[model samples]
Target chain A: MNPFIDIRNDFPILKQQVYGKPLVYLDNAATTQKPTTVIDALCNYYRQDNANVHRGVHALSERATVNYERTRDDLVGLIHANNRREIVFVRGATEAINLVAQSWGNANVAAGDEIIISAMEHHSNIVPWQWLCERTGATLKIAPMNARGELLMDQFDAMLHARTRLVAVVHQSNALGTINPVAEIIQKSHAVGAKVLLDGAQALAHMAVDVQALDVDFYVTSAHKMYGPTGVGMLYAKEALLEAMPPYQGGGDMIRTVSFERSEYNDLPYKFEAGTPNIAGVIGFGAALRYLQSLGMDAIAKHEQSLLAYATDKAESTGYIRLIGTAKNKASVLSFAVNGVHPHDLGTILDRDGVAIRAGHHCAMPVMKFFGVPATARASFAVYNTKDDVDTLFVAIEQAYAMFS
Target chain B: MFDLRSLYQEVIVDHSKSPRHFGKLDPCTHQADGHNPLCGDQLHVYLHIKNGCIDDLSFEGDGCAISVASASIMSETLKGKTLGEFEALFDRFQQMVTAPVDQPVADDGMGKLTVLAGVREFPSRVKCAILCWHTLKSAMHADSGVAKTE
Candidate 1:
């Protein structure tokens, strides 16, 4: 019996039918389906505690503010962060990376400075640094990945020098499911006096991500990936760095006192957080994290690994499906292609059987270019997915292969 | 609205596997690159236009079955047609694919292009099916530049 299969009932969306068939959602890397707890929390917040946070003196506003700030504190424990002030809330991982790029990156990166990123970074992580390079005249150096989609650590070490200011890399590749050697990257980067920022958007959901243990300077991730509300995520920075860096955007809540001339910025996290926050979303995000904790990360990781291995083996056994991103160490993603068919063709075919999967570059074009394929169909596992879902995927793949070939 | 079999009919698969007018033209006159950045589908439409008549037209790119087949079917139907006729074809094709899924397409001058009528079911794939026509439109009027389906 599968250890994790029993929890599927907790997620009501998984029990529904799609296209006159049972829905087998394997697109976790894109975004996860929410459990009823998260949904109910979001509903309850808007229904009961509906008010603007931080500004209004009303009881609803106080409740909203308390709940909103609670997510930041929850994130501190979730990522093993030291203090609540170290955690900063933003729209999502994309905006968190941009915050680092604009606030910290703008101040540090110079014309001759180097920002080292891996080939497997999402567009969110890649583009912000690329834009920073364009603005600051710094060079964006790429640490190449091997054929199996694993990063070359030796090459990454070689790339780092005194000129390297930051080593921004993904903790796990969304496209390939390759869990990177972030710990080593951080140690080596720090040896050369370069700060490390890990894009933990995928990693946060799949595995146990402890920012303190990793000792990385910055760790960015989103909530929607972890079965939370969309448009709410966290950036974990060391308090010293948070104190040193400038505010990303100039607005309310980020200031101590505003004036015509100048304004003193707020504390560590609030300095980064600007304007009216996503109050209900933040409340929902806290509930999501709590839900994940209740399930236990170790159990979720094991269940997902089993699913990944089972799906990978079954997909290869079909003989028509060619698996991409075959790293020795990987996560819940299984990206593959049919023998003579495009990924989208396979996707449309699978959709007929109500097996939802993501077929694209997965927002990692550089990884696609490295693999020399336009796109790959990915079936990513979540807490609620089971072996039956994997079986359904293979059955659909064989049918699609026959139809396309 | 998205009927799976109707969208991936036998014709789309055949054209995608063995795309007609698949390679680049040697003496290419009017050319424009088309890109569906969201899908990572890129095609370069090559036209051999002379005296308002499409002498020869072909495309070279990598895309989904829908896109590649649409380009193939489009090239096959558009070889001997004049510029005015190509415009009419573009209009009707766009109308057919972009039309609401519930509405039926009136058979104007689309010809075999109606094979692509299924694209209307999948709103996202509509960009893929019509990318070649947009490139063809750019090749007709503009000298040389990329055409984007935004």
Candidate 2:
């Protein structure tokens, strides 16, 4: 029996119809739909254990704190972090990267220092460091990529030098679905004494990530990208790194003692997480992680790989479809353009057929410019997706071409 | 579901495939570029004004059916109008596309320009259909900067 059977039933939203047909949710890169278990966890926390955590002395407070803190422990295993102390919760991956840029980036980078990123990075990874460089007189460097959307490691190696303080890159591109050679990237950056940060926003749900094995200095991912709720994400830094960096925001929970003359920050993880945490979001995240653990990451990865291979084969067989991001190695994302049909038109036609796909730059405008296209229609798959969904996508794309041509 | 036929009529599709007045005006006194950053739809509108009237009007760029068709219909409709006439027609065309789907626009002598009225149902494509008009407004004022539909 297939271990991942009845997965669609677990997500109540998947059962609903869009327009007049069943919804084909191929926009996983934008955000994953929550399963019933994850949704119930949020409702359950609010229904039974709703209270302010860390400060309340009542039983609800203690219960809420336990559930919220449990998520950190769950994440430690999810990413194979050293311990719970290394997990810092923030708004989302964007906010997590900003936290690192403001706290650690501000503390370490100085005038004339250089930070390196790649051509394929999302705006979230690129903009914060750009702002940091402009503020501190540091220089930002770019590593070029080849036609296949893979980073040219030789050029990246030549770019690194003694002044390179940090190297941030995307683990898996949301636009291209290319699983970058992050392991090689981390090793190369560390060889030059530069810390590496991987934005795993697109990789977290598709594969197994082990921070300890990859030995990346810092990692960031959002809960919504996976099966969890929005408004919550995690940043995994080395325990010592988290201990050394100052608090990102000053608020109730991030402080130990306050005074007009002097103030002391809280401990690791807590110091970076300010104000009242997203107690319900954390509870839901714990449920999400538990759901992943039950499914087995290896099984999930294998199933998604098969789905991607099948979809790619079908898409290539179509003579008129121009496939973008023909990376030899990719995940479950298929971005394409029909002959004589614009992406926006394709998106509207597909929506009429109840095939929901992302039709834009996928928040990675630089990648679009690199590929020399205005926009692309991206259909990304999830664990619940099947081969039938890809069939529907092919049919919808044919309709778009017929109507436009 | 949204009706694709209403939006992508035969006229709109035909004009998109073979746009009218689709080229540059080499010595036009007024010219401006228009861009919709959301979809990367770009167009350049050029106008030759003579004796307080538009003598020659042309456009060249890349856009979708709605935008390209709207520009094609626009160039054919407003090519020979006076400056005052062009301004009044611009207001009427804008009103026609933005008005509610159920409430029909006043038949203000648009001729083929009524094809774009289908966009009233698609609020997002309103920017696409009006990109050229905005660029035309800028060209009339002799603005060199690009007109962006944000």
Go through the candidates in order and give the clash count of each. 0, 0
TM-score of model number 1, chain B: 0.95
Give lDDT tens digits, candidate 1, residues A312-389.
888777877778899999999998878897887777778879999998889998888988898989999999888888
Q: Mark the regions of model 1 whose C-alpha exceeds 4 Å error after superposition.
A: none
What local lDDT score does residue A373 receive in model 1, on the 0 to 100 scale?
Answer: 90
Label model 1 with its docking quality class: medium
* lDDT digits (tens) for residues B31-138 of candidate 1: 889988767789999999888899999999999999999999999999999888888888888888988878889866678888889888777789989889998889
The alpha-carbon deviation from the true structure for residue A54 of candidate 2, after best TM-score superposition, in angstroms, is 0.8
Model 2 residue runs over 4 Å out of place are: A1-5, B142-145
| Model 2: per-residue Cα lDDT over B52-130, one tens digit each | 9999999999877788989999999988899999998889988998998889688568888888888888788899999
- In model 2 chain A, the worst 10-residue window by lDDT is A1-10
The Cα error of candidate 2 at residue A93, in Å, is: 1.0
